[model samples]
Target: MKFAVFFLATFLVASQCHGGSFRSFPLEMPTGYGDGVSHDDVRCASWRLAVEAQNIFGFETIPEQCVDSTAAYIEGGQYQSDSKTVNQQVFFYASDLKIQDNDVVIFNVDGTVLSNIPYYSQHGYGSEKFNSTRYDEEFVNKGDAPALPETLKNYNKLLGLGVKIIFLTGRLTDKKAVTEANLRKAGFHTWEKLILKEPSNGQNTLEYKSTERGKLVQQGYRIIANVADQWSSLKGGNQGLRSFKLPNPLYFIE
Candidate 1:
């Protein structure tokens, strides 16, 4: 993703015009992970809790078909969108947030990073289909390269630290299972959360996850931090949520 000042300006202006609302309130990253008794340590506990929740109940394991489909889209070509400028900006912004193994990133499909899903959708691929079917043995057996290998590896380290790993995305249901499978095959040893887009019945998957997380938080699990390249993740007024703002290199959402 390439960065352009013009696109950034446009994104800000467009967001204002659209009256977009984000929930996350940014907090400074603690100097370091401190002892569990310190204030920073409490924050770390919260973050760790969020990560663990993702590992335990995020989504089912990913299937091989999703992995192949994702790879095919990347190897094929990018599909152009009307908001080309902002998409490019988000891509570039997200790149700066990439800290090579230190940061735990929840990449936004529509904003932080663009996936092959769009390309496949445009090309009449089977990715648009969904059913009760989840990731299966057939999909796993025919796998190629994982869809997001590097991202998965970075999260894996967090898992090794006893920190929970998650992949919080707003992907369509059809692609959600496959994406999870790809991460699993790529050596992400933890069961990552796959946040899917809401269905036509007016369900908000993110909201549900947020509610579920609140329960965890009340149970004494605090979210240490969450990093994303887009404003979408911060739709509420919660200040304890930690976020890293980076330019969106890929022009995704307007």
Candidate 2:
């Protein structure tokens, strides 16, 4: 006779994008822990939690290592949305982990993600598909949107603190000039860098953002925070020190 044993586990990755970028060090699972338990199972569990973090709280990635007797801990609404407040903490059981905070932070340009756009109407708010014509129209009209008051205040405050800021967006790179104009028009005065997606890039948000962030790191920049509305903008490598998310239930990308 064979018996099955279920195991609960948590793992962490450094520098994941959660509405903002933050560093999350990985934890090693103990050896000879459970029967029939594979490393992939642990990773899958972690990935599921990461996905939930993004779906529910707009976290680009899980900020901390979490483990529980069952996966229900996360499913039970124990972790709230990150957008509700800046200082809220998510609870998780894990061995031992350490996080390092960086000084530079990255922001997504989409008003739904980071900056608030009071004048910009959320046209694709209820769209089912992300690559639809309506989405394209929305992006084109983003220039007409004005920045949100709270977001502008935070941007200015971070800037005043001498924290280097980078603007990363999935907008077509061809619209670089126009995007810059729109940002300035919307009161975004200064930034260390502005990254836009290229037409030929052929990479999803996760791949594109991760690759770009890696490039920045290679260039000697430390990414401490990442702010975005979409999960794609947050996942992947070179995540950073912390991540902050904005509410966007309109559409989701695989």
Candidate 3:
């Protein structure tokens, strides 16, 4: 019985280390898509890497054949494990920085600082076409977004190191209220600024982000790190000192 109790304690500690706050695994280690990986698993894994590397652009839907395999990858806890690895690198970068008074971390809201998994899980983990209206109503407008556990940890660590947090998202200007509420509900209590898209802007996300970040630079805020899941959100002029991309297999933008 004591051995059993000790085993449970070890698992809990390991879970905390793996950014496994959102999942509970019955196995000592994540099985990673059952016993053996199939052809579909290999295909989906490669596609997911391509998605992360921006090799594929403007992908509106995940491939139908890869949907089930993708689901297993996410639900089986490998998603969090992969995320933890990325954040571990990010944390290392942040740890070595010499923060200044105006130094800031740029955080893209959705799929970066926030997790929309609850909404996506019902939609086949992003295999379905993205319906902007439905997504806004059910996910955005409701102030129901949850924090990405890995990000929240690094965010606080950066804060403790004296760097200010600035949230820069592609969400529109009109969502200010619920966006603030959702951010707070998701455990982000403060930020230096919450920059959002202007409804009338004609530029794409990359252009929009570049323009906004330029303004911040002119105003004397030095971007320490620009963190986001979307490459568009991380690229362009005034890009910052360094950029870190988080793992997101759900969908691609720009």
Model number with the top TM-score:
3
TM-score per model over all chains: 0.41, 0.58, 0.84
Per-model root-mean-square deviation over C-alphas: 17.6, 12.7, 10.8
**Could you tell me the lDDT of residue 42 within candidate 1?**
38
Question: Which lDDT tens digits does candidate 1 get at residues 1-254?
Answer: 95332101010111221223212122344343333434333332332233222221222222223344333333453222223333334334444443333223344433233233333344333323332233223232233334333344434444544454445555556566565665555565454345565555353434544553454456444444444434445343331235443332221221
lDDT of 3: 0.79
Which candidate leads in lDDT? Answer: 3
Model 3, 198: alpha-carbon shift in Å? 1.4
lDDT, candidate 1, at 68 = 45
Cα deviation of 165, candidate 2, in Å: 1.1
Q: Kindly report which residue stretches of model 3 are placed more than 4 angstroms away from their true locations once superposed.
A: 1-35
lDDT (CA) per prediction: 0.38, 0.56, 0.79
Question: Candidate 3's residue-wise lDDT over 25-142, tens digit each?
Answer: 2323233534475656665676677668655455666767778988888778988888788777877887898778999989999888889888889998987878889999999999
How many backbone clashes are present in model 3?
0
Candidate 2 global CA lDDT score: 0.56
